[model samples]
Target chain A: MAYSDKVLDHYNNPRNVGNLDKKDPNVGTGLVGAPECGDVMKLQIKVNPETGVIEDAKFKTFGCGSAIASSSLATEMLKGKTVDEALQIKNTLIVNELSLPPVKIHCSVLAEDAIKAAITDYKAKSATPATAQTA
Target chain B: MDNHHNCWHCGTPDAGSIFCRYCNSLQAPVPNYFEFFGMPLKLSVDLARLQKQFYSLSGLLHPDRYTRRSEQEKRYSLEASSILNDAYRVLRDPIQRAEYVLKEAGFDIGEQRSKDVPPELLEEVFELNMALDELRMGDDEVLPQLDESRKKFLDILVEMDAGLEQQFQKHDAQEGDEARRAVLAEIRLTLNRRRYIKNLVNEVDKLLTARNA
Candidate 1:
């Protein structure tokens, strides 16, 4: 099925494509995959913990247009939002924003999952010491 | 999903005929991956067998055999090639294959609470998580200490994998329904832990990459 204009637009020209300083406590990296499709998405956020505001957002996704668009739009929406606000970003919103087709709906869902995963990763990282060597 | 018939070129012998039995030209198979593998619809599977079958099929029906075929025949070959790749990818990985099989069985592991990662794995998972966290935040001093734990984890996975293989062989050998069902349940759990540990290793690899970066 062909993606809509919006989906194609965001997909062909994705935004916020990069990684955050995952090692930096303030950076949250969300890495998640849909085992069904083998689609992986990594969403990152730079948040101001004291204020809970997401300062910068980025993503790297390997999947369909819907998947890429969903993540791009999710990060776009995350700019300046608090952690709670960003967490509240739903799959439907991403789907609606990207105009994803029904069959590709999971792409949007994965984007949402990636966001949560990033937040979780961020929180986990921040909760620990400033520098711990993991191998 | 495939449909089989006699090989149009040479109808000598045919089962799930995807080629002319005599000519061996490209054709469509009657059986799908699930049927070809003789597997139930579940998220977990016997991967080694799946790999073996995949190679077996590739040896026979790969598009290269149809290099001299008509345009329509080549199109069929291209589609078949892609499907083979897709099926192999889906069935080879424990997680992808498991989810697909679950859907085929009309079940959702994510929707069900009973399958929420075996509780037995909880302690191990927690310890791994805690250690990963500490390692991620710990100083370079911790690097020297991680080797033992990494080796231990690998050894455990290897042991479990071998045990699972034995169970799988027994299940496959079973001639009756009851024996098969029991083995299936055992495989399901073993596969889950295998998936979990695989993820942990990936996470460790990521942390290592991040450190190097």
Candidate 2:
């Protein structure tokens, strides 16, 4: 199937394609996979603790073009958004933006899941004062 | 066994068998693969018996044999022959058979998300992909690491197949619906993980072949 031009564009020049420090307490890493297609996506967000805003986002995806584009676009959407605002990010918005076909909708869903997972990890880390105190 | 229907040719009440007993006319074939094969709804299939049945049924349902027969019989033969091929192909392979059972049991096999996969497995998959990416980028140093990962994944596949065998037996041994559904759930999860690792192995194999070539 032909990919939408937007998908192709993002795939060719994936935005924020890198990794954040997983050991950093402020960085939230979301590692997820779509087993049906054997796609793995890692999305991370570094939050500003005081303002609770996501300051930086990065993603590295290993899969088809649509999957890579989905996660790449997801990281772009994650930056500058607060933790709660990031939680409100929907897969449908990505689908519309990417013009993803029905079969590739799951790729967008994977991106959305990655965002939620990252936020959850960040919240979990921040909730534990022991790690913050030690650091 | 509950698929009792009247024979189209003889109007005889048939017990869902392939052919009518009284007038010996071909009935509409059972759609369910297990029922069509006259096998119980179980995962542990007997290959020898299944093969014998396949050959016998293939002969019986050949369209050539129904040419001189009624048009209805000929059509039934054609339909039965098609379903027979599909049934045999799917039931012969253990993995396909398990997948068929899962689909029949109302499980959504195709729509799995990342949450379904265990976190540790995803981490391994991610690292393997990173190594693969390095190899793709002209980094020959990671080739040895790729080889090691490939071997590790292959070993995991072998171990997983053994585990699947046990799950199959467990599923077959369960008589209650609740117990059977529980086993089916486990089988589904195992199949998903197996599919992921299988893809990883295939990817590594392809890259290795390309490098060698």
Q: What is the TM-score of each candidate against the true structure?
A: 0.48, 0.90
TM-score of model 1 vs. true structure: 0.48
- Lowest lDDT sum, 10 consecutive residues, model 1 chain B, at B110-119
TM-score of chain A of each: 0.91, 0.96
Candidate 1: stretches off by over 4 Å: A129-135, B1-164, B167-213
> Which lDDT tens digits does candidate 1 get at residues A4-115?
8988888888999877777778998876655444455778999997998999999877566788888888889999999888889889987777777787888888888778
Candidate 1 lDDT over B1-213, as tens digits, reads 333455555565553445564565666543355754545544446678788888887766567877787876777777776777778888887556645544454444443111334434443444454466567786665565455556666887898778876865676677776666666666666665666666666766788788889
lDDT per residue (tens digit) for residues A18-81 in model 2: 9899979899999989999988999999999999999999999999999999999999998899
Error of 2 at B142 (Å): 1.0
